[model samples]
Target: MTNNSTCNPLLLGNQLCFPLYASARKIVAAYNPFLKEIGLTYPQYVTMMVLWEEKKITMHDLGKRLYLDSGTLTPVLKKLENMGYVTRSRKPEDERVVIVEITPEGQALREKAEKVPYAMGCLINRKGNLFTPEEVETLKKQLYRLIHALE
Candidate 1:
Protein backbone atom coordinates (compact mmCIF):
# COMPACT_ATOMS: atom_id res chain seq x y z
CA MET A 1 0.00 0.00 0.00
CA THR A 2 1.19 3.50 -0.84
CA ASN A 3 0.80 6.43 1.55
CA ASN A 4 -0.74 9.47 -0.12
CA SER A 5 -1.70 12.20 2.35
CA THR A 6 -3.03 14.49 -0.36
CA CYS A 7 -5.58 11.93 -1.49
CA ASN A 8 -7.53 11.79 1.77
CA PRO A 9 -8.99 14.84 3.45
CA LEU A 10 -11.18 12.48 5.45
CA LEU A 11 -8.24 11.11 7.43
CA LEU A 12 -8.77 11.61 11.17
CA GLY A 13 -5.21 12.84 11.73
CA ASN A 14 -5.75 15.60 9.19
CA GLN A 15 -8.76 17.10 10.99
CA LEU A 16 -8.53 19.72 13.77
CA CYS A 17 -11.94 18.84 15.15
CA PHE A 18 -11.08 15.24 15.98
CA PRO A 19 -8.51 16.09 18.62
CA LEU A 20 -10.72 18.85 20.05
CA TYR A 21 -13.65 16.46 20.31
CA ALA A 22 -11.55 13.71 21.86
CA SER A 23 -9.95 16.04 24.37
CA ALA A 24 -13.33 17.48 25.41
CA ARG A 25 -14.71 13.98 25.99
CA LYS A 26 -11.67 12.98 28.02
CA ILE A 27 -11.81 16.12 30.15
CA VAL A 28 -15.51 15.66 30.81
CA ALA A 29 -14.87 12.02 31.73
CA ALA A 30 -12.15 13.12 34.13
CA TYR A 31 -14.73 15.37 35.80
CA ASN A 32 -17.20 12.55 36.34
CA PRO A 33 -15.90 11.16 39.64
CA PHE A 34 -15.57 14.60 41.13
CA LEU A 35 -19.02 15.62 39.91
CA LYS A 36 -20.51 12.35 41.15
CA GLU A 37 -19.30 13.13 44.65
CA ILE A 38 -21.42 16.27 44.57
CA GLY A 39 -24.40 14.33 43.21
CA LEU A 40 -24.38 16.10 39.87
CA THR A 41 -23.53 15.08 36.34
CA TYR A 42 -21.11 17.14 34.28
CA PRO A 43 -23.82 19.02 32.39
CA GLN A 44 -25.83 19.62 35.56
CA TYR A 45 -22.71 20.74 37.37
CA VAL A 46 -21.90 23.26 34.64
CA THR A 47 -25.49 24.49 34.65
CA MET A 48 -25.36 24.91 38.43
CA MET A 49 -22.06 26.75 38.17
CA VAL A 50 -23.68 29.33 35.94
CA LEU A 51 -26.70 29.56 38.21
CA TRP A 52 -24.45 29.90 41.21
CA GLU A 53 -22.77 32.88 39.63
CA GLU A 54 -25.89 34.50 38.21
CA LYS A 55 -28.19 33.42 41.06
CA LYS A 56 -31.06 33.54 38.60
CA ILE A 57 -31.34 33.81 34.83
CA THR A 58 -33.85 33.18 32.12
CA MET A 59 -33.82 29.76 30.53
CA HIS A 60 -32.96 31.31 27.20
CA ASP A 61 -29.98 33.11 28.71
CA LEU A 62 -28.85 30.00 30.53
CA GLY A 63 -28.97 27.99 27.33
CA LYS A 64 -27.00 30.65 25.49
CA ARG A 65 -24.33 30.75 28.18
CA LEU A 66 -23.99 26.98 28.15
CA TYR A 67 -24.17 26.76 24.34
CA LEU A 68 -26.97 24.28 24.69
CA ASP A 69 -30.30 24.23 22.87
CA SER A 70 -33.69 23.77 24.50
CA GLY A 71 -33.92 20.13 23.48
CA THR A 72 -30.73 19.47 25.41
CA LEU A 73 -31.20 21.93 28.25
CA THR A 74 -34.78 21.16 29.17
CA PRO A 75 -34.05 17.70 30.48
CA VAL A 76 -31.08 18.91 32.47
CA LEU A 77 -33.18 21.64 34.04
CA LYS A 78 -35.91 19.15 34.78
CA LYS A 79 -33.49 16.83 36.52
CA LEU A 80 -32.08 19.67 38.60
CA GLU A 81 -35.59 20.71 39.56
CA ASN A 82 -36.35 17.14 40.56
CA MET A 83 -33.18 17.05 42.64
CA GLY A 84 -34.37 20.19 44.47
CA TYR A 85 -31.32 22.09 43.33
CA VAL A 86 -33.21 24.49 41.11
CA THR A 87 -36.61 25.85 40.17
CA ARG A 88 -38.02 26.68 36.75
CA SER A 89 -40.92 28.97 36.15
CA ARG A 90 -42.45 31.07 33.43
CA LYS A 91 -41.73 34.75 33.39
CA PRO A 92 -44.68 36.83 34.58
CA GLU A 93 -44.31 39.52 31.95
CA ASP A 94 -43.72 37.08 29.16
CA GLU A 95 -45.30 33.69 29.37
CA ARG A 96 -43.08 32.61 26.51
CA VAL A 97 -39.97 33.06 28.61
CA VAL A 98 -38.85 30.65 31.30
CA ILE A 99 -36.56 31.34 34.21
CA VAL A 100 -34.23 29.14 36.23
CA GLU A 101 -33.10 29.78 39.76
CA ILE A 102 -30.85 27.90 42.16
CA THR A 103 -32.34 26.81 45.48
CA PRO A 104 -30.70 27.22 48.91
CA GLU A 105 -29.70 23.58 48.56
CA GLY A 106 -27.95 24.44 45.34
CA GLN A 107 -26.27 27.44 46.95
CA ALA A 108 -24.99 25.22 49.73
CA LEU A 109 -23.59 22.80 47.19
CA ARG A 110 -21.20 25.49 46.05
CA GLU A 111 -18.98 24.97 49.08
CA LYS A 112 -18.52 21.33 48.12
CA ALA A 113 -18.17 22.16 44.41
CA GLU A 114 -15.53 24.78 45.12
CA LYS A 115 -12.85 22.10 45.41
CA VAL A 116 -13.59 20.58 42.00
CA PRO A 117 -11.50 23.03 40.00
CA TYR A 118 -8.48 22.58 42.29
CA ALA A 119 -8.80 18.82 42.12
CA MET A 120 -9.02 18.86 38.33
CA GLY A 121 -6.04 21.20 38.15
CA CYS A 122 -4.01 18.80 40.26
CA LEU A 123 -5.04 15.90 38.03
CA ILE A 124 -4.05 17.82 34.91
CA ASN A 125 -0.64 18.76 36.26
CA ARG A 126 0.06 15.48 38.03
CA LYS A 127 1.98 13.47 35.46
CA GLY A 128 5.07 15.59 34.96
CA ASN A 129 3.05 18.74 34.21
CA LEU A 130 1.10 18.15 31.01
CA PHE A 131 0.67 21.91 30.57
CA THR A 132 1.79 25.01 32.42
CA PRO A 133 -0.84 27.45 33.71
CA GLU A 134 0.05 29.95 30.98
CA GLU A 135 -0.21 27.26 28.31
CA VAL A 136 -3.59 26.21 29.65
CA GLU A 137 -4.88 29.79 29.56
CA THR A 138 -3.60 30.27 26.02
CA LEU A 139 -5.22 27.03 24.90
CA LYS A 140 -8.49 28.06 26.54
CA LYS A 141 -8.49 31.44 24.82
CA GLN A 142 -7.77 29.82 21.48
CA LEU A 143 -10.57 27.33 21.96
CA TYR A 144 -13.01 30.15 22.78
CA ARG A 145 -11.85 31.94 19.66
CA LEU A 146 -12.54 28.86 17.63
CA ILE A 147 -15.98 28.56 19.19
CA HIS A 148 -16.74 32.19 18.44
CA ALA A 149 -15.54 31.80 14.88
CA LEU A 150 -17.81 28.82 14.44
CA GLU A 151 -20.75 30.74 15.87
Candidate 2:
Protein backbone atom coordinates (compact mmCIF):
# COMPACT_ATOMS: atom_id res chain seq x y z
CA MET A 1 0.00 0.00 0.00
CA THR A 2 1.27 3.47 -0.93
CA ASN A 3 0.77 6.43 1.39
CA ASN A 4 0.10 9.41 -0.87
CA SER A 5 -0.46 12.22 1.59
CA THR A 6 2.95 13.64 0.65
CA CYS A 7 1.81 13.80 -2.98
CA ASN A 8 -1.36 15.68 -2.13
CA PRO A 9 -3.08 17.47 -5.00
CA LEU A 10 -4.53 19.84 -2.41
CA LEU A 11 -1.29 21.75 -2.12
CA LEU A 12 -1.78 25.46 -2.76
CA GLY A 13 0.47 25.64 -5.83
CA ASN A 14 -1.06 22.49 -7.26
CA GLN A 15 -4.61 23.83 -7.28
CA LEU A 16 -5.84 25.55 -10.50
CA CYS A 17 -8.11 27.94 -8.60
CA PHE A 18 -5.33 29.83 -6.86
CA PRO A 19 -3.80 31.19 -10.04
CA LEU A 20 -7.20 31.92 -11.50
CA TYR A 21 -8.21 33.82 -8.40
CA ALA A 22 -4.94 35.73 -8.22
CA SER A 23 -5.00 36.57 -11.93
CA ALA A 24 -8.57 37.79 -11.71
CA ARG A 25 -7.66 40.08 -8.84
CA LYS A 26 -4.61 41.39 -10.67
CA ILE A 27 -6.54 42.09 -13.84
CA VAL A 28 -9.29 43.90 -11.97
CA ALA A 29 -6.73 45.87 -9.99
CA ALA A 30 -5.13 46.90 -13.27
CA TYR A 31 -8.34 48.71 -14.05
CA ASN A 32 -8.25 50.79 -10.88
CA PRO A 33 -6.36 53.86 -12.03
CA PHE A 34 -8.34 54.35 -15.20
CA LEU A 35 -11.59 53.52 -13.48
CA LYS A 36 -10.74 55.92 -10.69
CA GLU A 37 -10.29 58.69 -13.19
CA ILE A 38 -13.83 58.03 -14.40
CA GLY A 39 -15.22 57.59 -10.88
CA LEU A 40 -16.02 53.90 -11.31
CA THR A 41 -14.85 50.59 -9.95
CA TYR A 42 -14.26 47.39 -11.90
CA PRO A 43 -17.67 45.96 -11.01
CA GLN A 44 -19.39 49.19 -11.89
CA TYR A 45 -17.48 49.39 -15.17
CA VAL A 46 -18.53 45.91 -16.27
CA THR A 47 -22.14 46.56 -15.27
CA MET A 48 -22.10 49.66 -17.45
CA MET A 49 -20.59 47.72 -20.31
CA VAL A 50 -23.54 45.35 -20.38
CA LEU A 51 -26.03 48.15 -19.88
CA TRP A 52 -24.41 50.09 -22.69
CA GLU A 53 -24.82 47.14 -24.99
CA GLU A 54 -28.33 46.19 -23.93
CA LYS A 55 -29.85 49.72 -23.49
CA LYS A 56 -32.38 48.37 -21.01
CA ILE A 57 -32.65 45.05 -19.25
CA THR A 58 -34.69 43.59 -16.46
CA MET A 59 -32.82 43.34 -13.19
CA HIS A 60 -33.08 39.59 -13.40
CA ASP A 61 -31.65 39.56 -16.87
CA LEU A 62 -28.88 41.94 -15.93
CA GLY A 63 -27.98 39.79 -12.96
CA LYS A 64 -27.86 36.72 -15.18
CA ARG A 65 -25.75 38.44 -17.80
CA LEU A 66 -23.30 39.67 -15.21
CA TYR A 67 -23.12 36.35 -13.34
CA LEU A 68 -24.21 38.29 -10.27
CA ASP A 69 -27.10 37.94 -7.86
CA SER A 70 -29.57 40.64 -6.90
CA GLY A 71 -27.83 41.12 -3.58
CA THR A 72 -24.61 42.05 -5.37
CA LEU A 73 -26.25 43.96 -8.22
CA THR A 74 -28.80 46.03 -6.35
CA PRO A 75 -26.27 48.36 -4.76
CA VAL A 76 -24.37 48.84 -7.99
CA LEU A 77 -27.59 49.76 -9.78
CA LYS A 78 -28.58 52.03 -6.96
CA LYS A 79 -25.21 53.79 -7.10
CA LEU A 80 -25.54 54.26 -10.84
CA GLU A 81 -28.99 55.66 -10.32
CA ASN A 82 -27.65 58.05 -7.74
CA MET A 83 -24.95 59.11 -10.16
CA GLY A 84 -27.62 60.12 -12.70
CA TYR A 85 -26.33 57.45 -15.06
CA VAL A 86 -29.28 55.08 -14.86
CA THR A 87 -32.83 54.69 -13.71
CA ARG A 88 -34.46 51.72 -12.02
CA SER A 89 -38.14 51.08 -11.59
CA ARG A 90 -40.54 48.25 -10.94
CA LYS A 91 -42.20 46.96 -14.08
CA PRO A 92 -45.87 47.87 -14.18
CA GLU A 93 -46.99 44.60 -15.65
CA ASP A 94 -45.00 42.59 -13.13
CA GLU A 95 -44.14 44.52 -10.04
CA ARG A 96 -41.83 41.78 -8.89
CA VAL A 97 -39.59 42.45 -11.87
CA VAL A 98 -37.45 45.57 -11.86
CA ILE A 99 -36.29 47.32 -15.02
CA VAL A 100 -33.07 49.23 -15.40
CA GLU A 101 -32.48 51.75 -18.14
CA ILE A 102 -29.48 53.90 -18.79
CA THR A 103 -30.13 57.60 -18.60
CA PRO A 104 -29.34 60.20 -21.27
CA GLU A 105 -26.46 61.14 -19.05
CA GLY A 106 -25.28 57.57 -19.29
CA GLN A 107 -25.59 57.76 -23.07
CA ALA A 108 -23.43 60.86 -23.03
CA LEU A 109 -20.88 59.04 -20.88
CA ARG A 110 -20.45 56.48 -23.61
CA GLU A 111 -18.34 58.92 -25.59
CA LYS A 112 -16.03 59.23 -22.62
CA ALA A 113 -15.99 55.47 -22.20
CA GLU A 114 -15.11 54.92 -25.86
CA LYS A 115 -11.43 55.33 -25.07
CA VAL A 116 -11.42 52.96 -22.11
CA PRO A 117 -11.05 49.79 -24.15
CA TYR A 118 -8.19 51.22 -26.15
CA ALA A 119 -6.49 52.33 -22.96
CA MET A 120 -6.97 48.92 -21.36
CA GLY A 121 -5.60 47.26 -24.47
CA CYS A 122 -2.52 49.42 -24.28
CA LEU A 123 -2.01 48.40 -20.66
CA ILE A 124 -2.44 44.77 -21.57
CA ASN A 125 0.22 45.11 -24.24
CA ARG A 126 2.73 47.03 -22.22
CA LYS A 127 6.42 46.01 -21.90
CA GLY A 128 5.79 43.77 -18.92
CA ASN A 129 2.48 42.55 -20.25
CA LEU A 130 1.76 39.01 -19.09
CA PHE A 131 0.28 37.75 -22.36
CA THR A 132 0.29 38.69 -26.03
CA PRO A 133 -2.97 39.80 -27.60
CA GLU A 134 -3.46 36.42 -29.22
CA GLU A 135 -2.69 34.66 -25.97
CA VAL A 136 -5.07 36.93 -24.15
CA GLU A 137 -7.85 36.02 -26.57
CA THR A 138 -7.04 32.37 -26.20
CA LEU A 139 -7.05 32.66 -22.43
CA LYS A 140 -10.44 34.40 -22.56
CA LYS A 141 -11.88 31.59 -24.67
CA GLN A 142 -10.46 28.98 -22.34
CA LEU A 143 -11.84 30.80 -19.31
CA TYR A 144 -15.28 30.95 -20.92
CA ARG A 145 -15.07 27.22 -21.51
CA LEU A 146 -14.15 26.68 -17.88
CA ILE A 147 -17.04 28.87 -16.79
CA HIS A 148 -19.50 26.91 -18.89
CA ALA A 149 -18.13 23.64 -17.62
CA LEU A 150 -18.49 24.78 -14.04
CA GLU A 151 -22.02 26.00 -14.69
Give each prediction's root-mean-square deviation over alpha carbons.
Answer: 1.8, 3.0
Model 1 segments more than 4 A misplaced? 1-3
Candidate 1 residue 102 Cα shift, in angstroms, is 0.9
User: What are the lDDT scores of the predictions, listed in order?
Assistant: 0.94, 0.88
Using lDDT as the measure, the top candidate is 1
Tens-place lDDT per residue, model 2, 33-138, is: 8888888888888889988999999999999888899999999999999999999999999999999999999888888777888887789878677777798799
- Candidate 1 root-mean-square deviation in Å: 1.8
- Candidate 2 yields a Cα-based lDDT of 0.88
Tell me model 1's lDDT, rounded to 2 decimals: 0.94
TM-score of each: 0.93, 0.89
> For model 1, what is the alpha-carbon lDDT of residue 133?
79
Inter-residue clash pairs, candidate 2: none
